[model samples]
Each structure stands twice: as C-alpha cells, then as structure tokens.
Target: MLASLRQERILAAVRLHGAVRVADLVDELDVSDMTIRRDITELARAGLVRRVHGGAVGPDTGSRPAHEPGFEAKRSWATAEKQAIARLALTLVEPGQAIALSAGTTTHLLAHLVAADAALRPLTVVTNSLAAAEALHAAVTPAGLDVILTGGVRTPSDALVGPVADASLAQLRVDTAFLGVHGLDGDGLTTPNLLEAATDRALLAGAAHVVVLADHTKWGVVGLARIAPLDEVDTLVSDTQLTAEARRALDPLVGRVLLAPPDDPTPEPPLDPGAP
Candidate 1:
C-alpha cells in the first residue's frame, strides 16, 4: 500500500479505538516495525496522533499530561480492560477486611463487585468516590458492609478531593487501597488534578498495602500531578494488553505485576508480599 494510505489507516485506527499499538499496526498494515514507527512519527509531527512508548493515541484522547476528562467520558474508553482489572482486584479482598477505593472508573467497577459478593460480608469500605459509595450503598443490604464517603470538593472525575478528604483519610487505616490512576510511568502514579493527587496520596498513606488498577494505555502516559512512586505499590493489576517488555521493566519497580486476561475473569493467586 502507498505511504499515504497506510498513514491514513493508522490514523483511522487510532481515532476509532482511542489508541493503537505499533506491533498491532504493523500486523494489520502488513508492514515492517520500522515503517510503522516512521509513519507514527510523521503523524505525530503533523499533530494527527500522539505517540506513546510502543503505540499512538488519538490527538484529542486526553493524551496530554494536563488533560482531564469527566468520569462519564472516560468510562467508555476501555470498558473491557477496566472490567478485567476490577475482577482481578476483587480477588485481593478478604472477608472482614477494611479497604479503600480511590476515585476512577476501574475502582468504581470494583466497588460494584465488592457490593454484590455476600462472601465478603462484614467488611468496611472507605472511599472518596461518590459513584463507588453509591454503588456500595444501593447494592448491599442487611448491614453486611459499611460504606464511608469522604467529604471534600468534587472533581470532574467524581473524586472528592481537598484538605477535608485528606484529613478524613489520615484518621483511618485500611487493609488495602485500590487506586485507579490516569497514568503510570517512570514518574510514578499520576492524575491530572493536583488536589486529587494529594487525596490519593493520603489514601496511599492510610493503607497497609496498595494495588494500582491501570490499563495498558496508561503505561507511557504521564499526568500533571504525581500521586505515589511505583515502589510504593504492592501490586499492579493490568490487562493482558500490557507488553511483556513493559512487565519486565515494571516487575522490579513494584512487588508484583498481575495481568488480567480481557475475557477471563479468573484471577491469579495473590502473591505473598514476604515471598522472595
């Protein structure tokens, strides 16, 4: 195919899916890796697509570090991957344990799972997500689970963040915290909103263990505000789309990396943090 046609196809794929991996593009376009990389470079130079570590995302797909989209807009971006991560994260919860869910669509989904599971009864959940609090409140009955919502200013992503939220988090401790982040790269866990980042950090501080829930697309992207470093995370649950190279690089940064198959809900056994 002609270079123009190949580039057009690449742009179309990125726009349609919000992001496209270079390897997948090479296979779909029947071209060499170098050719796909060159095309992506050209498109990026033309401001047609934003290049990430191993792929490209649409120019307007919140690729910018400072770009912040409302929760509803982000909920539809990677529904399957988020669901897979949520399911894997659910396996980390134990009966009678207190947990915290930070504000994000992925964590919000996990909240729904926790609310429905009677086996996880007599549990306490603290969160800064209004959506998560609502899901837990409406889904569970007979007082098996306790839901606590922090008070603070709300962000576009439906997270309550500010000094109030931070203070509330500081007063309590949880067995685990499942954080949903905007990006997770060398700079660490991040979010576009600074206040939200501070609140997220408070969430991290109050948990005995921390699990970050992110999809493959968040691998290379960085956000405006830093939450916590990768070393602080006990485990990271992402979808199978996360490249093997990415996993190798990330393994040493965190305690362990768990890849949830997009179609498979079964989770890998939790690794003991003390295990070598």
Candidate 2:
C-alpha cells in the first residue's frame, strides 16, 4: 500500500510542478526520507520517473501485495461475515450435543460463538485446532461442558494431526461436525496439509451431520488433498456474497446451503437436511 501511494504521489507532483524534487515533496507528504528516496528509485526503474538532482520522479507500475490476508490481517476482514456464520453454526448445536470443529480462524470464531451461547446451553466439542480448542476450553470447561482436544503431531498452524488425533476422533461419534477448509471445489473440500487432510477425513467419518463453515473466499480454491466430496456435506454456512457460479455449483452438492444475510436480524430459512 505504501508503494502504491508513493507512485500516485510522484505522478501528482510531476503533473503539478512539471518535475518536483523528492526532497521538496518529502516534508509535504510526511513520508520518511528513505522511503521517499526508495519510491523515487523504484519508480525510475519502472520508467515512471525521471531521476533529477538528489531525487527521482514517471508511469512506473509496480506489483502490489496479493490480497492474501496475513493471519492477524485476516482476523479483521470478513470478521462480521465469519461471526454470522459462527452464529448460524452455534444454532445447529443443542445442550448435550457433541460436535467436531475444525481449524482456521473462522472456526475459532465459531468456538467463541459457542462459548457465549446462552441458549445452546451445553455440549461436548471435539477439535484438532489448537486455537479452536483453546477458545472452546476456556468457555465450555468452565461451564461444565465437555471439550475434547485430539492429540497428534502439531502442524505449523498449530493444528494437531496424524495418528493420535485421528484415533481420538475416530473413537467417538459426534452429532455434528463444523469444518473449515482452505478451499471447496467441484471435486470436494481440500487442505494444504496432508495430516490435516487425514484428520478432516476422520471428522467426516465420526459425525452424523457434517456442516461446513466457510466465508466466501474459500469457494473456488483447490488445495493438495481432497478431504471429502462436496455431496457429503449436510449443511454449508457462508456469507451471501458468494458468486452466482459458486451458488449453482454448491446447490446440488449440499442437502442445503445457507447464506447468512449481511444486515438485519431476520432469521434464515431452516434446511430440512431431512432425516437420513
């Protein structure tokens, strides 16, 4: 963003002053002396600027950071969207119900929603995500709700996977499984990590109703391993901003796909993922 802004400012100055000095604009732009100089050099390299005395100044286009959210950065964007999905996921729960929750920040938000839930009353929560387990443990354990964390080899994202987690998850039956994925494609849900993929597969086997909780961005991304076929999911909760193609593609796979309304408190239509 800083790079993009500098490019714009250099163009504005060139247009206004017919070639402004980097030194002259430095004080006006409130930018660092080094940053101004670097921007000028970069612009000149891209042919957008003409180097002048002690400065540089032109239509040089440079790359912008891919919109991929850093962990902390993503925690903010679509927060409301994730929160709504989490709320919808919570409504799927009932006291004494046991559900499998997956990894990812959105799932962490779901854990938070479950914790604050007054009406859901109580339930057992199973998870492989360290972050999700941390959040759920804090809420459910204090309230006497059962919380299970699968033990396994820890991955970079702090997700537990491999033999231990898989065995633990396989040993129990859950009422529902709330899964978050890196991507959901025509082929199925996928993950970048092989261990996580195996654990996800286990989650699918041990649950009665499989609910996918994802925001809109996860629609088309294809990852390394297939967790499950799209048709296996009983419910999908996502923001209404899903593309038309995504809506069409997912409609046939899920028993029902739910789009959380961005504004207003209106209740969404209930899906009859009718008794299997």
Candidate 3:
C-alpha cells in the first residue's frame, strides 16, 4: 500500500479508537514495525495525533479537553474488552459487601453482573451512574440488594457529578469501589469533565480499596482533569491487550495489576447457583 493510504488508515483508526498501537497497526497494514513508527511520528509532528510510548492517541487527548462521548457511544468502542474487564472485576467482590461503582461504561457493565449474582445477596451498592443504578434496580431481587444513587448534575457520560453527589459519597463507606476512567498514564487516572473528576475523587475517598477498570486503549491518553495519581489505586483490572511496559509501570504504583483473559466464546455463567 502507498504511504498516503496507510497514513489515512492510521488516522481513521486513531479517530475511531482514541488510540492505536504501532504493533497493531503493523499487523493490520501488513507493514514493518518501522513503517508504522514513521507514520505515527509524521502524524504526531503534523499535530494530527499525539505520540505516546508505544502508540498514538487522537490529537484531542493532549492538554486540551477531550470530547466526552455519550455513554452509549462510549459503550460501542470497547465492548469485548469492557466485558472481559467486568468479568475479572467480579472476582474481587465478596458476598454481603457494600461497594461503590463510579460512572463509566465498564462499571455499568459490571453493575449488571453484580445484579445477576445471587450469592452477593444483602449487598449494598452506591453509584453515581444512572445506567448502573437502573441495571441494579431492574434485576435486584426483593430484599437481596439495595441500590443507592447520588443526586447531582448529570454529565454527557451519564455520571452524576457536583456537590450533591460528592456529599452523598462522603457520608458512606464501601468495601471496594470500581472506577471506570477515560485515561490513565504516569500522571494517573483522568477524565474530560472537571466535575466528574471531583466526583470520582469523592468515590475514591469513600472506598476502603479502589479498583480501576480501564482497557488498553486508555493507557497513554490524558484527559482534561486528573482524578487521582496511580498511587491511589489499590488494584487495576485491564484487558490482555494492555502492553507489557504499562504492566511494569503499574506493578509498583498499584497494589495489584490484573489482566483479564480473552473473551470467552460462550456466555458468562452466573456467579452462584443458589437463589437469593
């Protein structure tokens, strides 16, 4: 393929996925690694993309405010990776534990898994995600689960943010909190919305442990506001697509680093067989 065509394909991928690894591009374009690297470098120089350690992210992901896509749109970006991460996140939940789930597509996916798990009966779930709250509300068996939704202004991502949500989170404490972030890097977790960053911080404060659920694509992308530094995270559950260099960087800063297995062909089974 011509260099111009290859570059256009690279640009399209970065625009669609928010980030693209050179290795992935090399495979997809059937070109040498050096070829992809040169394309990424050229694109980065032209201000069309932002170069990272092993890949390139969309131009908007630099110091500027990222375009926060709606929850449904974000949901379509990484369905397999999110589902795998959500499945891995479920293992950390114990029966009868109060947990907090911050608003994001991945956390919303986990909420459904949580709702369907009969063994987690008598569980209390606090969240600022309208989608997650709705999922829990629809599937929760009577007297088996309690769902709490914070009151606050909603963001484009369906996250409740502002003083009301922060105050609500401040009053409650949970055994664990699963955070879905827009970006993560040496600087820490980040999001496009400033108010959402504050709300995420509040959620972090209320949890005994913090587990961030992010896919490979978010590894090097930075957003408008930082939520918290890497040291604040207790565990990070990501899909297998996460790079080795990222894992090495996270091992010391994060208490635990977990990579979810590749997606299973069969549907996920229930957490437990016993009824609530």
Candidate 4:
C-alpha cells in the first residue's frame, strides 16, 4: 500500500481507539514495524496525532476543548514517577490503619503496592476506584486487606463517582486519604469530571490527613472543576522531576511537599522541615 494511504488508515485507527499500539497497527496494516513507525512519525509531524510510547493518540487541537484521558492512557504516562510516588506513599501506611484512596492512576499504583507488601497487611482501604478494588481483591494474600469500594457511576478514568460514592464515603472516616488529580495549581487540585470532583471532596472529608499524589505534569494545568485547595492537603507527594522553582511556589500552599526520587526505590527525605 502507498505511504499516504497507510498513514490515513493509521490516523483513522488512532481516532477510533484514542490509542493504538504499534504491533496491532503493523498487523492490521500488513506493514513492517519500521514502515508503521515512519508513517506515525510523519503523521505526528503534521500535527495529526501525538506519538506515545507504544502507539499514537489523537492530536491536541487547541480548538477542541480539553478532557481527561482514559485510565489506561494515563497509566502508561510517567509510570516510573507514579511508581516512585507510590513507594513513598506506602511508607506512610501502618498496620491496622484505615486509608482512603481516591480514584486516580497514582492511587491505583498505591493500592497495588499495598496489596503486594506483606508488612502492610491487615489494613482497611476505602476507594472510589474499581481498578484499585480489583487489584486488592486479586492479591495473593487478600485475607488481611479489607477493601471497601464506593459504588457509583463509572467515569472515563474508571473512577466511581456520584451521590452513591459520596454517601458511602461520608459515613466512614479513614486515617489518610491518597488523592490523584488531573491538575494542580495555585488555586487547587482539579479534575475535568465534575461528579468525580464531588466524590474526591467526600474522600478528603472522610480522612484525617489528605495526601495529594500527583506528578509534575499535572502542575499548572487546571481542570474544569476544583476539588480542594493546597492548604487542605496534609502532604503533596510528587516526583523529583518537579522543579525547584515549582516547589518554592507550592511551599506556602500546602503543609508539606515530599519529592520521590526516581532512582531511589526508598522514599527520599522531605525538602521542608517537619514534613511527614
């Protein structure tokens, strides 16, 4: 097939699926991997698609309104950073403690880490993420971990939101709440989904300590709805990739900021004094 035709087909597939893997595209197009990569590269150069690790995503046209990507799409981005943040967040969990995990890819990673750690067993986890609940449920030693899933309408990000989730969270209190957000700025942490924002607020209210788990990418990008201001957060956990300037700017907004270094599996020491 011609290069133009192949590129057109690839663009169509990416538009249809939101994301398309390289191997699948190769098989579907009956083209070599190199050929597909070249076509994708050209398409990306033309601003028709955004090239991701294993696939392409629809172009970010300024004309079109911004929206949150799906759970899988987000899970693939800043993976190392998310894992590092999760590892650090796990250190805060104690045996027999109850924690609430708000719906987000970072929190989902935290849930997986909690399920895998034998030391953190016998803990209760309340969450609005179906993904987090399922990960915990499928753990090898799920007996020790109690997972409470908030039943509600599922959003594109796989977050369970709405009145049902809010009501469920309101009745119970947890020691800490791990929140993942689409965007965090001077104003507050925000999400594109309004209902999910409401549910996240409920999770925040249910916990004594609110920890916001976000990557550097989330900074400066404001979402449609505000969840809570930075002052309300007990700790803000992000990767070391976060600039020093950004940290200085965020210092007064939140109680504490913990930077998780990517190279170090163990949690790094907090930048600020008296940080937890």
TM-score of each: 0.78, 0.68, 0.82, 0.73
Q: What Cα-based lDDT does every candidate model obtain? A: 0.83, 0.71, 0.84, 0.80
Highest-scoring model, TM-score: 3
- Kindly state the number of residue pairs that clash in model 1: 0
Query: Candidate 4 — what's its lDDT?
Result: 0.80
Q: C-alpha displacement of 62 in model 1, angstroms?
A: 5.7
Off by over 4 Å in 4: 1-66, 140-143, 265-276
lDDT-better candidate, 3 vs 4:
3
Worst 10 residues of 4 by lDDT: 267-276
Cα lDDT of model 1 by residue, 1-276, tens digit = 999999999999887888887768877989976688779879988999976545777776654434567777577666788888888899899989999999998898898788778899889999999888877876555568888899999888889999999999999999999999987777588787899999999999999999999988678566667899899999999988787767877988999999988677454222222211
Better-scoring candidate (TM-score), 3 or 4? 3
lDDT per residue as tens, model 3, 150-243 = 9999887889999999999999999999999988988799887899999999999999999999988778666788999999999999988787
Candidate 4 or 1, higher lDDT: 1
Report each candidate's C-alpha RMSD, comma-separated, in the order given.
Answer: 7.3, 12.9, 5.4, 9.4
Instruction: Give a tens-digit lDDT track for model 2, residues 7-107.
Output: 78887787665565545667778876556766776776777765432344233211111212233433544566777787777778888788888877677
Give candidate 2's whole-model lDDT. Answer: 0.71
* C-alpha RMSD between model 2 and the true structure: 12.9
Better of 2 and 3 by TM-score: 3
Indicate the TM-score of model 4: 0.73
